[model samples]
Target: MQAALQAAGQGWHVFPLRPGSKRPALHGEQSCPRTGPCVNGHLKWEQRATTDPDRIRAAWSQAPFNVGIACGPSGLVVIDLDVPKNKSKGSSDAPDGATTFKALCERAGHAVPTTYRTRTASGGRHLYFTAPPGLHLTNTAGTIAELVDTRAWGGYVVAAGSITPTGTYESLSGLQTAVLPAWLRTILQPTPKASQAPATAVLGRSNRYADVALANETRAVASAPVGEREGTLLRAARALGRFVAWGDLPRHLVEQALQEAGQAAGLTAAECRSTLRSALNWSIAHNQTRRETA
Candidate 1:
């Protein structure tokens, strides 16, 4: 409880978790055990999570619950390094978990920055880092490497000092969270400009309007909610693809933006490519139909 208060003091939004469990201490119709029907009891703790001391006090006062820190609002991203309780074989010599993490760092050509590391109850590790601006990194598994996962926006991580049946989340002494590395950023949160079209092509005034439209649509896709991301990506693709149909923007540029936006929303590169192809085809057909009608 004291740890939770301290986290709130440090400006990290916090909420209570069921004791020794990672589940938020939420109440709902399905959650209640009483014979009476649940009344105004479904708690959306993720949305209601706050830094207010009085609320924190009231919450922890009820029971010795664990602390859960909301990652996005706190501007934090956590890389969860989970070791298998049972060992698994790979690549004749490759090991999963922390060993895989080491290999990943080596492959990236840099050491994992010294940061706030927490040892989890199951002997896993959580490395906390400040999130990059405007990029909402989501939970990923096996994307970085085997047995490695990440927690970011729309997610939460158990904070240090929380105790579970397995063990406690203990912080390693003498380390602070570090800024995310540029190379890591490239893998985790790539930008649309990485594959930008060359400047050699002279743009006519008609094309200039398309350029502005693409820029706005790109921003909208980037900022869309996770639940809405796929639709947003399709919409952006159709809009930009319309410009491509009209020869206002290069087809490659529209395709690139859709690829970047799709990946940002956790789609595989191949998935993005496939979706872009379908969306572009629909857009071209729709535009042709409109032109014929006109």
Candidate 2:
């Protein structure tokens, strides 16, 4: 408990985990009543996690819970090195976690700096580093290598002093959180933003006219919330419009299907008609470009 408080004192947003486990120690049972699969509550720790001393005490006082570190709030990025227990069953040529991490550092031409390290109960390692400014890193599995994962924004890592059935998460003394490496920065960073157009779906000219793209667009339109009706309709129109330009679906048939989908998604008739016209115009322009290029 004191260790958790101390971690919070050092600017880590600490939360309670279930004793002897890595799951969050949330108070209430949260489930999706309609869909039967909860979306937001599955990661409630990210929302209710805090560094406040009082909240930390209140949480831990009820039970001897393990400490969980909310990485994003703490401005920390954690490299999780997991060694598989079933390594003997896998191919011998497959490199282990340590070997993969070492090879990565070798490629970067420098050893990883000694950082605030935590030896996880499962015999894995968690190397802590300061996140780079304006670099939004999300959680990824095997992005670096097999058995290796990262916990960044929207993720949590069990903290040092947390004990579980496997073992205890113990700190490696005499180390500080180091700056993220330039090589790692390149790999872990978010992709640069580009144009807002949705990725084009490849079309084929086979006699099998299944209209799979239209079916997908219809589903998207139906599932979209009221606020997204306009954008969803526009995207659906553009996609179906492409098929029209490719001489796959007839223009009138495509327009009718789009109009039906837009109306089902709660768009006004006027809005649907106007968006349909614009999309057909876009398709006309697309065909014109193709002709000019040819």
Candidate 3:
């Protein structure tokens, strides 16, 4: 561990990986049985024992500061501590079960400060953070897990190359390291500032995709609730504006899964309409919650 930190000091790329390399950061053994075939055709996301140890290490070498740890496969399900700034320095605008990530960067010395945010599967928020300078990035990752707010779940996948915006890993450019700084033994997220977008010279808006982006967001706002036909319903709602009515919602055959989820419930037409209304309401609330937390 000390050598890796020294290498980082010399600007040599390092990857702080576990023995199995399924995760870049070290996490105590935590596993749950998933008997059926895993979604990626494996048994479970966290079943590190199933992964080829060689591949886990290989993925860690993508670039300097990129570390690999054995995540039990389901990936790290961290409770992100990222939050927007409070309305005032102490206006008590903190989120429910939330912590601020912005403060950590300001406090981190000799480190290129970074803050990250991601959406949870439940439309909640997740925050990303680079390990402080001189500490192994993987080590920082491990520490942050403990610092996460109560909203987080301890176990999460630590696979590399994942585009999860909520995840934080190695350095991307400019005097980067494959590992985090060794100096930083531990860190906790900071309190947020305000929620406004940074007030830099507003570069002319990227208007080319404005229409499409709004449509997509609104469509996201209208998609099914958390526990519904998540994939199919989202696709169907995305095709909403184009369709004249529910019949046209399919707009068809995107998948063999058409309304079967609720059909077995034998809901009446009124019940269906009421259920959809409820879902729409739920989606809007969820999106709003996300926006506020984000």
Candidate 4:
């Protein structure tokens, strides 16, 4: 109860999670009784989360419920830095989220900002930040880098006092939550449709084979199903990368086309950018010899 109240004191809405688990304790939609709070309709966890002290007290009194902080209502964008689950065979140097995030910051010519931080049960870190006003950023998985995720609208975070079977979540810093940095926000923000012009305008139709390949690959990425979208985007980027290396297509144009296609298929801007960049780099490097001989 005190744990939920502390989160509520920070102006963050709180909800109950199952004791010793991260799953929500509130009745799910399928089993909603539609009584009392749900008199009109089935209220989802996000909708039912509240900052009211009475409600928090009532809910927590029944059991030692874990606290869940709803990010959307709280106006927070939490950057989750996770540790690698398991080391690959013969590789003891698996990169963790903090290391990758630090590299990402250095590449952008910035240092990681000090903010309200928490240590998760699984030995992961959560860096809390205030969201930019009026920007409704959605949750992302591996959008910024491997093991880095951002949760905003439609997502929730376990409060600092919550405990799971693995371990307990504990606060690491008392520092104020920082406003999300501009460079990081730029990566998360979606590209406006008005700015995305047709690929033909950028790439032109001079090489029919290259043009056809670009169109086909991008189309495949855009139409890929949810489970296969990321792989499709990576494959498309790799397939088109050779054309860029061979001087048959411009790198920027190919990147732009594929990025837009990946976003269209529900991939986040950061995810597309990261995947496209790595895939293209590998494809270009590996195909350099073939390009030189041609």
Q: Stretches of candidate 4 above 4 Å error?
A: 87-92, 194-276, 279-294
How much is 165 displaced in model 1, in angstroms? 1.2
What overall lDDT goes with each candidate model? 0.71, 0.71, 0.31, 0.82
Provide backbone clash counts, one per model: 0, 0, 41, 0
Candidate 1 differs from the real structure by a C-alpha RMSD in angstroms, to one decimal, of 11.2
Best by lDDT: 4
lDDT of 4 by residue, 1-294 (tens): 988998898899999999999999999888989998999999988999999999999999999999999999999999999988874344548889999988777645468888999999988999999998998998977757789999999999998999998899999989479998876776566423211223343244325657788999899989977556666776677777777876677999999999999989987898789879987886777666333111
Alpha carbon deviation, residue 224, candidate 1 (Å): 29
Encode model 1's per-residue lDDT on 1-77: one tens digit a residue: 89798777767789889999988876754666543222445445565677999888988999999999998887788
State the displacement of the C-alpha of residue 15, model 4, in Å, after optimal TM-score superposition: 0.4
Model 1: lDDT of residue 67: 96
The C-alpha RMSD in Å for every predicted model, in order, reads 11.2, 16.9, 21.1, 11.0
Top candidate, metric TM-score: 4
- Candidate 2: C-alpha lDDT: 0.71
Where in model 3 is the C-alpha error above 4 Å?
1-45, 48-79, 82-92, 95-99, 110-117, 121-154, 157-178, 183-294
Which tens-of-lDDT digit does each residue in 1-294 have in candidate 3?
Answer: 332343334322334445433344423324423333333433322243233334434544543322322221212222344333452356555442233223223222233333333343223344333333332222123223223342212234322323333343332233222322222222222212213322231323322222343344344433433223233233333233222121222313211122333333332334333334433333333332212212
Single out the weakest 10-residue window by summed lDDT for candidate 1: 190-199
TM-score of each: 0.59, 0.60, 0.23, 0.70
